[model samples]
Target: MFGELEMVKALLDERKRVVVLTGAGVSAESGVPTFRGQDGLWKSFHTQDLARPDAFESRPELVWEFYNWRRQLVAECEPNPAHHALVELERQIPNFLLITQNVDGLHAKAGSKKLMEMHGSLWQVRCTKCTHAREAREPLPDMPECPVCGHLLRPGVVWFGEPLVAGVLKVAIDQIGRSDVFISIGTSNQVQPAASFYQLAKDHGAVTVEINLEPTPNTGLMDFAVHGKAGEILPELTTGLRESLS
Candidate 1:
């Protein structure tokens, strides 16, 4: 770990464009469930069946029930050390971007500024009829309605079979292309496009690192891998970075 910290420090000292990608593990540290791995159940229906456009179109109330439940669950948790450490890192590095696959909004709560939510957020609502979307922290009704269109409001997250928001994906790709350092934390490395980002960064000459509880399929490709809880590891790494870059 000491040796890897040295390498992480070296990467930080360069102070070039740095991108950090996070997944469910980070949010799990804050007590958010990896909902996909759960029983996938929702009132006798599979969650996977409900997390698609077709489900929302067919049974909007059921979809809203699931997302609203998720929203409350996520809202109960607080940002952990890793989230705060990343906020400090963002402050330290001018060209830093934090990309997260989780929809919990813990990063935003941690004060991350140069951040992009790859999976949208549970705290936001969008109208099905109009293009209205806004952040809402309170618990949503079973069938939230848009202020503008009065249409049913839906969770802002990316559902199954849905493509990522194009504009967001473009920015994420641009950041990965420009980054000189890419850090992957708490990800399974199975989700497409995002799972491929570290490699994309490496291909573009970035030093890629993976920090996870255990190795995944792409762990072998990482220039460095740190196996540990992100909350414990990130703060220590960020402290070293502050010293190295001070």
Candidate 2:
């Protein structure tokens, strides 16, 4: 399925605006656990349930405990070659945007400058009362009180039943709409709005690529569906882009 590297290179060579959307699969290669993976259960509770506002309201400690555990897990991971490759790709492309569904901050650690964490970041905290957000560098308490409002602080991520932040979503959609090439890496394509971006970019005439370990629901719609570890595939693919441009 990856034999069409030449075609992708052609698009890169054209210097078209490119946008990349990544998901948990990209971080999975670096040892971060996926939200719905088999091992995601904690204390007999589904990881998904622990991320909701209702969950936090009912059991804030449980939610914070889950996120704290996840934060530590993410801290243990380092950005792999795929993350580095995307950083280099950003450097090489003048019109580029790196958007991710991941809450992990690995992409930023890899030096991607023009990035949007559409799902928010694990290294941030939002006030439950005032909604003011601030960077969180250290592990927080189970009931970290927001200094700004004295209310509880919540994980700075879009939870189940919550809408994606308007500004972040707008930027992602704008870039996808204007991009000439859109690549989705390691996403399951089951999440909406984000999942719909591939089709949006395709409809707007972008050449789309799906790079994942396996084909997903959106694979059939891609101009290229290359199944493999993104850690391996992305570096090789970007290497081709670099060599072709050089």
Candidate 3:
């Protein structure tokens, strides 16, 4: 409960390139489950077992069932205050990039333009057989076969054991490396690469800020750790940015 508004504002005013790396905590504010934590994983399935390419390949229908549940969850939750606040921060700051680990698409829904979806999005579909390029769309009920290669349609998310899409990862790394400020929101900081970005940004001289409900796993590394719900903290912070930058 430090004042997120003033501190975030100061960081915004001082920094040029801002990189925002978000996690499940932010999406949890919008009502999505922290799916990787204890007592999660598609009806007693382990996250390691369910969220893997091998699992999807072995039992596509089961994978679809799990992701379909996630898709509906994302579909139901609206963007929280934090998401909207980041959208406003993008408007206020110059050269801002949003890099999100959550597959839920709330950041885009909040109108953030320059974004790197590190974990991919649920609202997309790709062919399994030929590996067709992705299309931004909803999942179908019949689970229609791909038009080109007749492979099954699968939800587009970064499955476990999959390297993040190289193109997106490159952009994320570039943004983090070039940033003078890095803001971490609503993430537990346990996941790799996404968790690593804040350190990467800090290593490149970016002032690191963490906005979340508690001290994150990487709290020791952050320059400013604001402990609270992101929904309440971010709008106030965005308002501070407006006050300071003006």
Candidate 4:
């Protein structure tokens, strides 16, 4: 972990632009269960059934129940070391972007700037009928209605069948396709859009680095793959980079 981190740090020091694409692995450090993991509350319900737009239409109360539960869980968790490291990394690097797949607001909580939430955010709400969305101040108790259309509102997160927001996706692709360096943290590379960002980065001649607790399918494709808990590894790597940049 130490040796590879220094090597990656050397790349970071030299790179003009560094873009990061992070997955649920980054937020898991903060005690948030991933959407697909057995520990996740979604175990009882299939993600496709609960998260889709059709599901919300058919069962408004169920959709609210699921999101409300997730909100409660997120409310309990705080940003962990991995989240803090990214914020610190952003502060040090002059050209930087952080793209996160996890809907949890841990990145913002850790003070990360230049962020793109590709999968949407759990702290937000969007009207099922209308396209309006907002950062919610209070958690949903009963099935809430859209203020504009008086239709049911659901979590703003990207569900199974829904497309990623085009504007946000376009921006993420633009950065990933042009950065001099790209780092992937804690994602398994099983999901699309976010997984494809790595290849896009590599396609554009970016130095690629992966930091995770264990290697995944895409491990072999990365320039460097460091296997360790991201919270522990990222802080160490970025801490050195911070001092060096200073």
Best by lDDT: 2
TM-score of 1: 0.95
Tens-place lDDT per residue, model 2, 135-173, is 997978878998977999998999989998878788788
Q: Which candidate is the best by TM-score?
A: 2
* C-alpha TM-scores of all predictions: 0.95, 0.97, 0.93, 0.95
Tens-digit lDDT track of model 3 for 49-126: 888888888988887788777777778889988889989988987788888998888899889898888888888788
Stretches of model 3 off by over 4 angstroms after superposition: 3-5
Task: Score candidate 2 by TM-score against the native.
Answer: 0.97
Poorest 10 consecutive residues of model 2 by lDDT? Answer: 1-10
Considering summed lDDT, which 10 consecutive residues are worst modelled in model 3? 135-144
Residue 53 accuracy (lDDT) in model 3: 87
> Taking the tens digit of each residue's C-alpha lDDT, what string does model 4 give over 1-246?
678889998998898899988988888888888766566447478755787878877887887888888789898899998898888888888899999888888899889978988888988988867788999958675888888999877788888888988788888888888899999999999888777778899999998999998998989999999999988888898888878877
Clashes of 3: 0
Per-candidate alpha-carbon RMSD to the true structure: 1.4, 1.1, 1.8, 1.5
Off by over 4 Å in 1: 39-44
If both were scored by TM-score, which would come out higher, candidate 1 or candidate 3? 1
Q: Give the candidates in order of lDDT, highest first.
A: 2, 1, 4, 3
Backbone N/Cα/C clashes per model:
1, 0, 0, 0
Q: What TM-score number comes out for model 3? A: 0.93
